[model samples]
Target chain A: MDPSRLTIAQASAAIAQGSLAPLSLVDSYLERIASLDGELHSYVLVLAEEARERARALAAEPSRGPLHGIPLSLKDIYWTRGRRTTAGSRLCLDFVPAEDAETWRRLEAAGAILLGKNETHEFAIGGPDFTLPFPPARNPWNTAHYPAGSSSGSAVAVAAGLTAGALGSDTGGSIRGPAAFNGIAGLKPTYGRVSRRGVFPLSYTLDHCGPLTRTVEDCALLLQAIAGHDPLDPASADRPVPDYRKALERRLDGMAIGVIRHFHEADAVAGFGPENAPNPAYCAAFEEACRTLEKAGARLVDLRLSPLLDYADANRLIMLAEAFALHETDFQERPQGFGRYAFARIGLGAFFSAADYVEALRARRELCREFREATEGVDAVVSANATAPAPKIDTVPLWGVFERASYTAPYNLLGAPALSLPIGFEDGLPLAFQIAGKPFAESSVFKVGYAFEQATPFHRERPPIAASLPGRT
Target chain B: MAEPIPPDRFTVLVERAGLKLTPEEFEELREGSRFVERMKESVRRSGPREARLRGVTRPREKTAEPAHIFIAGKD
Candidate 1:
């Protein structure tokens, strides 16, 4: 495989064996980023010299870890010491943190090379705002379509082979949305599984840090390097960090899979896409994914919980309330610093009374309890991540987030582990389904995601834009 | 959905929030309030009414220090 196309594990193995030097790997990616990122807009800032210097240093040393010599991009929200962390907003264009985000520190310790800062939805809740200092990431599958965000650039980088894997934070499906849209694997680990210290806050209670990568195993590898307790992060889980890559070795045989069929089927509000009718492709792909699991020795059971709208409502209220709290002063003082979509979305928070915010929290507990009770019989729940493939970028409305009920939001609200993996495609764009597990049961989520990845050939199909890149063998 | 917050009340809330939205922006927000109203209704419907009442009716325990700050997935 071309160096850029190689999974983290494959590249690590090659690098460890000295067949591929870290410098060469970084160079290959930099070359590809140079060639593709102009069109893809996957990176906001390219730290070419820093990346090359880090790669050269790694090339001289023995492997520090599985992530040693690997090149990765951080969503611009992750504070990198002395590097501009724009959080995809013009307001923070000059902002640079003196310390690295805990995840960034951990990855750097694992010998990962910094590729650049990937673009994001402003403050992770903004729209695909073109008015921001940086352009929104273009979907590598089809440049004209929306790469579901706010981890837009992170997914684009991985899908287009601009970076090996990228760190993406999910407040409400940001990581998984882009992963699904771009045809890659995205894992939003159980809340607090990865520390959020030094990452710009989106929703303090709801935000989750995770990864987007080319494969389930790669996702596990990236998570392994980043997941740990940080004393500075109040929500950081102090539980023992499991060997995620080793956990991937386990088979999915005999695992009980709960299929949340109604979320996407009946409740999903199709927003921008031309297809208002039920997406037959998505329906067929989801059914095929279930069959793939069954063939892999997993038992599929139909499971229903609270209506998707209920979860969406609770999640939106909490996120908006919390995000507004975080940026309230700024929103008041200089609302012009924010993009129109971000301002409009965050502005909704102004109307929510303290009673409303508290009520949402109470409702959150109820919904989470329901989900927990519903999933007790099953190891994980499978559902469509997005209603369809990427929509036209311009077609996404400013109110789209409020207008739709997400398959991914329930997991966000539950603070559970959810993985979005490509199942198939429609109109040459990827379609995905999420495997959600109980809080802290990322092992189960990865097991199911890996089994599905192995049984299907969807992961093997690269975006045509990437395949057509000159000099790619 | 809960009845739309009257424009006068909405204006007060925006002023308290210190946001300076133009009339055009406020009009757009007025339109968007329908979504928020629907969401508020859903949350209210879903909330545990008894829990809220109990929270208000039975507030006794007072601690000098905050509750334990254990993280999720940890003891």
Candidate 2:
């Protein structure tokens, strides 16, 4: 059996049934990483020896849970005790954390083996920067293309089959954007759903830690292991986490799904430019995805709230204000320590006044209220995740993020659960759409995403890099 | 429409932010300020017109509060 190709659920089941040994699965991924990651640049550090030791140790014990023996990577921003956690900046090349991030500690206790640390955009806010200590992760579909970041390596690792799953933090569209570009399943759980303690902060109010996996079901399994409140995280939700996997069986029949077509077809384009319009192929794929959901007995409703730019601007302002505050000392003491992208992007925060930050906070409240009221009658809302497939890496301008209105940022502002799953392909690259639910309504989002995933083959399709492997072909 | 921060003004802000940048980095950030101006414009345009018109001195509806709130001593 090829353990490298199995999803987290399948590998867990195999390990539980005694068909797949934990060591073999870990070895499978390590070997794949050795063969592929040189060009992909997905991992900043590969824990081959540590992973093998852990796998052997787990092999001696009975199954711990569904994630038992599963190998996964984490974005470098997540602190792993005694492991170098570089947040992709040269400033912390040798910095090591004294303790594990709450999320990583939970994953470890659940019997999942850590394979490595994935690369991230510097401080999780920078663009793909060449000046960083590590090279930016390239898309698996085509090396020359961009892998939407700062969870760039997490999505690349999963999509390239280097790891069964990865944990990533999302502020704005970090998780969902890369997931869309890589054609994997990425979830940005409702704010405070997962503990962020020990993970480097981008924006205190907007950051969320979640899973990136090959399929929606795998995403659920990973989320189950990580979700819940952590007292250490002041913002962690105190609510109980539902059985996300079992909830996946819930049908989409008779569910009300809001389709925000204007987000991509009009608002984003009007705000950016004609070049920012979603590709025709992407539009067709989104239409087909809507049809697939409708066929699954979901009722599609056209919904509109605040313009996309409103949410985008608010999200950006808050993120910048908070991020700069956190990194101000670094920016001042050693401005040259930062990569060019991180330096310039975070520097923009200094231009905004104290009143601007407070205004953004107020705007956030209004946008959230508007979203909740508009989505009151709907179980979930669907929209384009990325308007186009990954573009040439160099073509992306340093200020490109500011130039476009993100379809994913509205959910970030609302602190809602949003999932990005593959819908189709455009020009051999992946195309994806997002399904967002009310705050803490990940189950509804999963139900809608799973329904569409099962009806389409997009999730099952592997990137060319994965397919080109000798036996995989 | 919002105009980008003037170069002299941008230089002062950058200096006040305590970031010492190369001329190249400064120029890049100066160019990037246009987007910041545009974003500031959008944010200024958001929220209730009554609040903005009153210059934010008027009391807002009781239930309308900032998204992030702090309750001192509450955990």
DockQ of each: 0.29, 0.47
* Native-to-model Cα distance after best TM-score fit, residue A311 in candidate 2, in Å: 0.4
Q: Rate the local accuracy (lDDT) of all candidates.
A: 0.84, 0.89
Cα lDDT for residue A318, model 2?
90
| Cα lDDT for residue B72, candidate 2 | 89
Candidate 2 error regions (>4 Å): A471-473, B47-64
State which candidate has the highest DockQ. Answer: 2
What clash count does candidate 2 reach?
0
Off by over 4 Å in 1: A249-251, A269-277, B1-4, B47-75
Which candidate has the top score in lDDT? 2
Clashing pairs in 2: none
lDDT of 1 by residue, A1-473 (tens): 47887889999999988898888888889998888888989899999999999999888888898999999999999999998898888799899899999999999999999999998899998878888878888998899999989999999999988999999999889999999999999999998899999999989888999999999999999898888888789888889988776667435777899998867765554221233334888899989889889988899899876666777888898898888898988987888888988888888888888877877777777777778888888988898888678899988989888776577888888999999999999999999999989999998888888888888898888987776357657
lDDT of 2 by residue, A1-473 (tens): 67898989899999999999999999889989999999999999999999999999999998899989999999999999999999999898989999999999999999999999999999998879987889999999999999999999999999999999999989999999999999999999999899999999999999999999999999999899999989989999899999988778535877999999888877776666677888889899999999999999999999977667768888999999889999999988888889989988988887888877887788788878778888999999998899788999988889888886688888888999999999999889999999999999999999998988888999999987886357642
